[model samples]
Target: MYINTVSHYLPSEVIGNEYFTNINNLSHEWIVERTGISERRKASAEENTSTMAIKAVESLLESIPYSKNEIDLIIGATYTPYDTIVTLAHAVQHQLQIPDIPVVSISSACSSLLNAIEIVEGYFALGKASKALVVVSDHNTAYYNEMDTVSGHLWGDGASALLISKERQTDSDMHIKKIITGGAATSGKAIEAVVLRPNDRGVIMPFGRDVFQNACVYMPKVSQQVLHACGLSIDDLDYLIPHQANHRISLNVINTLGIPVEKLISNIQYLGNTGCAGCAIALSENKEKFKKGENIVITVFGGGYSYGAMLITI
Candidate 1:
């Protein structure tokens, strides 16, 4: 599968670290030192996961001359959705006015984008679809609690869209070389380490030490698996894009892999942790920086003790 275009959308409202510092009674420098996030965008009342997804898809469609009818598959990835019954993929299809296409929603937390890519790759390999729209939209602000400083302050709202096709359509297209995903429930207690409850006071709670430790181990493991599957080593990677869950996690993964820090592509300092949209948003934002024939390795770990990696050629 080839990526024809990638587009991302961020809301107008920017929430700085000072907002969290004042609300949580923590020092601004402390938050930055721990998470390396300075600011993040929060969706306005009018924007939800679906709306932000549509905006991204529209932006991607506008850039490419492909007709909406050409898109036969629509995949939506998000853990934070306003409505559970009406999937974000269906909402995007409704907005785009596409008929009878398969609209699938994936909820694999931070690894959602990589999972979606694997699904689209299967569809294309099976001759089931020619054009696919993969969108990841998350609005964590809707469920965030001011009192919960652990995971609450790390989240932001945004969406990213990718247009994937069976064949390369442009000279700038990126090819998906390999995608590998796996999950390990270390223990029963690990299952509840990261969760967003269903109650009215739904707030994301993360066991910091468990998450950090697991991320440090699983991210590099999965990345090496994908790299080996593609017959490439860490030194062969032109860029390393890991899920922007935490700056510490990113640094740990880089150190574990022994990859140069300059080759790592990170925008978490400005965008915060956007759940499923983080890696895709980073990829879209840095699309122009990649040179032809260069290789990129993207690794991600999220809730459910899930982790995955993908190798792409630019």
Candidate 2:
């Protein structure tokens, strides 16, 4: 599979650490030192996951020569959903007004983007779809509790859209070399680490230590496995775009992988954690920096104890 184009949408509302200090009494220095997050974006009252996704797609269509009718598969990924009944996939299809195509929505926490791409790979392998659109977004502020000091300040809203083709659509298309995903729900403290119960606190990380520990271990491990599968190594990678969950975790993964610090790409410092959209947003934001024949890795570890990694070549 090849990525024809990518685009992202970030909400206009910016929530700085000072806002958290005033509301939750958490110091700016403490938040930045712990999570490396000085600020995050929050959606306005009129915006939600689907709305941001639609905007991302619109933005992508504006910059690319792709037509809405050319898309045969639409996959939407998001854990924080506005309406489960309607789903993000259905909403996008309705917005595009395309009929009789397979539309699917999936949520695997922060690993949702990779999982959606894996689904696209399956569809292409089975000859079910040629051109696919993968949309990932998270409306964390919609269900987040500003009073919860554990993860209140970490929530952000953003969305990304990717146009993927079974075959290369253009000379500059990025090739999807490999993709792998797995679950750790049965692992230690995996299920209890992060929780998002609508009836309870919108999003909470009661056992953040456990989440951090596993993420540090699995992200690099899966990254190495995917690279090895592609017959490449860490030194061959031009960029490492791990899940933008934490700056410390990213540093730990690079240290474990023995990659140069400059190869790491991160957006959490300003966007905070956009859930599934973080890595995609970072890719879109930094697309210009990547050159032809460069290799990039995207590894993710999400709240549901889900994890994944993909190797792409520009």
Candidate 3:
């Protein structure tokens, strides 16, 4: 499977550390070091999970000329959706004027997207569908405990959409070379960055330090596993796109693996923690940075202590 196209939508309102200084007890220096985020785009009042996804679909459609009938599947991967069961994918289909296509809504916290990745990969492997869509959206800004300080500075809101299809032919220019995914079972009590209250409950709360520690271990190990499965090591990849968890987790993973910083493509400095959108956004932005036929490893890690990686050759 290959990602045919990708589009990202970030709100116009950007919040810096100074906003948190007045709202909560925090500093830019600390946020920049710990989370690797200098600024983040917060969704405007008009934007929600579904609307954000719609914007991405609009952008994606502009690149690929396709009607809804061509889309056999629409998968929404998000921890924060419009509703518990309803998702952004359905809204996108509606906004795009397509009906009757099967839409699957899935959640794996920060790891929600890789789960969707697996789903798309499998659909192609089984020859079940030709063209598919994976959309992710997070209105996490609304969930943050501005008064609680735990998740205020770390969370941001954004959306990303991707179009993927089965390799029409070997020479078709879109093919998925390999994918390796895994998860680690950390102490359940140690997890954070979860919805304390359901979609209708309390609010979004994240245990920053706890999430960081698990990521340090979870990210590198899975990346190595993905590399090993493909019979290639980290040294072979031209770029590494790890989950945009935080500044500390991303650097620590690279450091632990002994990978050069130049071999990685990171946008956390601009977009903040976009959760599942990180991989799609990073891959899209770094397309020009890679040499043709160069290999790239994209890693996705999330709050449930879930971690996974994908290795692909462009």
Candidate 4:
């Protein structure tokens, strides 16, 4: 599989760390020292997961040379949904008006993006589709409690869209080398570490220490697994994009893998944790910087004890 084009949408409203200090009584210095996030974007009242997803798709369509009718599959991934029934996938399909293709919506917390891509890979392997559209969006603020000091400041709203093809269609296409994903819900404090329950005070992290420990372990472990699956090494990677959940997690993964800190790509500092859209948004942000023959790896870990990694070559 090859990535033809990618795009992202970030809201205009910016929430600085001081905003949290006022609402949650968490000092700016303390928040920065812990998460390294200075500010995060907040979606407007009219904006939601599906709307941001549509904007991202519109941006993608503006750049692609082909018609929208060529897209055969549509998949939406998000844990924070505006409506569980209609789904982000249905909203995107309704906006794009692409008829009669397999449309599905899935959630596995932050790993949903890679899981959705893996589904596209399955479709390609079965010869059921050659071109597909994957949209990932998370309206974290919509379901987060700004007053609860635990995880209220860790979220922001954003979305990303990826256009993938079974065959390379352009000179700039990035090759998908390997993808690996798994669930650790049975192990470690995976189930209760981080959670988002409806009418249960939005998002909360009662066991942040456990979530941190698990992320530090799995993000690097999965990164190495996917790299080895492609017969590549950390030395071959031009860049490593870990889940944008925390700066410390990204640092830990790179240090564990012997990857240089300069090779790390992250946006949590400015955009906060955009849930499953984080890695995809980073890829879209840095799409033009990758050189030919360079390799990039995106590893992720989400709240539901879900983790995944993908190796891509430019």
| Candidate 2 C-alpha lDDT tens digits along 13-109 | 9999999899879999999998999999999999999999999999998867567798999999999998999999899999989999999999999
Which of candidates 3 and 4 reaches a greater TM-score? 4
lDDT of 1 by residue, 1-314 (tens): 88999999999899898897778876779889999899989999999999999999888987874787899999999999977889999998998899998889988878899999888988888898999999999998887776687777888899999999999888888998889998767733458778877675665555778888888888899888888898888888889999998898899999999988998899889988888999999999999889999999889988887889999999
Score candidate 4 by lDDT.
0.93
Arranged by lDDT, best first:
2, 4, 1, 3
Give the per-residue lDDT of model 3 (tens digit) for 1-314.
77777778888998888888777768888778677889888898878888888888787888774565688888898776766655677787777776776688787777787788788877877887778889988888766666656666777788888887775433323345766665565545345455545645444554566667777877788788877887888778677888886767777888999988887688788888887887787776766666667887777767556777777777
What lDDT score belongs to each candidate, Candidate 1 first?
A: 0.88, 0.94, 0.75, 0.93
- Model 4 CA lDDT for position 191: 90
* Clash list (residue pairs), candidate 3: 35-247, 193-206, 197-202
Error of 1 at 25 (Å): 0.9
TM-score of 2: 0.99
Instruction: Please give the clash total of every predicted structure, in order.
Output: 0, 0, 3, 0
Per-candidate TM equals 0.97, 0.99, 0.91, 0.99
| lDDT of residue 25 for candidate 3 | 62
**Model 4 alpha-carbon miss at residue 84, Å:** 1.2
lDDT, candidate 2, at 88: 97
User: Among these predicted structures, which one has the highest lDDT?
Assistant: 2
Error of 3 at 207 (Å): 4.3
